[model samples]
Target: MPAEFRAGERVRVRAGDPAGHTRAPRYVRGQVGRIVECQGSWELADEVAAGVAAPRVEPVYTVAFAAGDLWGEGGHEVTVDLWESYIERAERAERAGEDGS
Candidate 1:
């Protein structure tokens, strides 16, 4: 499948406590971040770990989250490689309101 997000696009990590293993970091869940790069398609790690016979392949991306946004401290950003299913496009209107626009 084609990548759902491109570099420079904003996305919010899906927030949920899944029953099984997941690659999405706990701290980044529900946080908004920018897609820094598309890492190409790869087998879904969660499915692979679950022993699925045929894991689905999906787009992966490098996302950059502001440290302040994730922990309320620091000026640096943290980058994480996340699967497409782990994130959703962040709404533009919400972003505008966040920065007092």
Candidate 2:
């Protein structure tokens, strides 16, 4: 499937904390960040980790979060490679009161 988000767009990490393995970090959940790069399509790590039969491939992105936004105060930014399923459009998240911004 085509990428749902592109570089330079704002996205919010999904906040769900489902049981089992997940690559989405606890600190980043419900946070808004900007997509810095598209890392191309790859097998979904969460599914792979769960030993799914034929994991689905999806777009991965490098997302940058301001340190201040993430942890109250800091000068630098943190970047994380996140699968498409782990994020959604920031506007949508904001409308739903999920962006914590």
For each candidate, what TM-score against the reference?
0.95, 0.88
lDDT by residue (1-101, candidate 1, tens digit) is 99878899899999998989999999999999999999999999999999999999999999999999999999999999999999998988988998799
The best candidate by TM-score is 1
- lDDT value, residue 27 of candidate 1: 99
Per-residue lDDT tens digits for candidate 2, residues 61-91, read 9999999999999999999999999999888
Backbone atom clashes (below 3 Å) for every candidate:
0, 0
- In angstroms, the error of model 2 at 65 is 0.1
Q: Model 1: what TM-score?
A: 0.95
Q: Write down the worst ten-residue block by lDDT for model 1.
A: 90-99
lDDT for 62 (candidate 2): 97
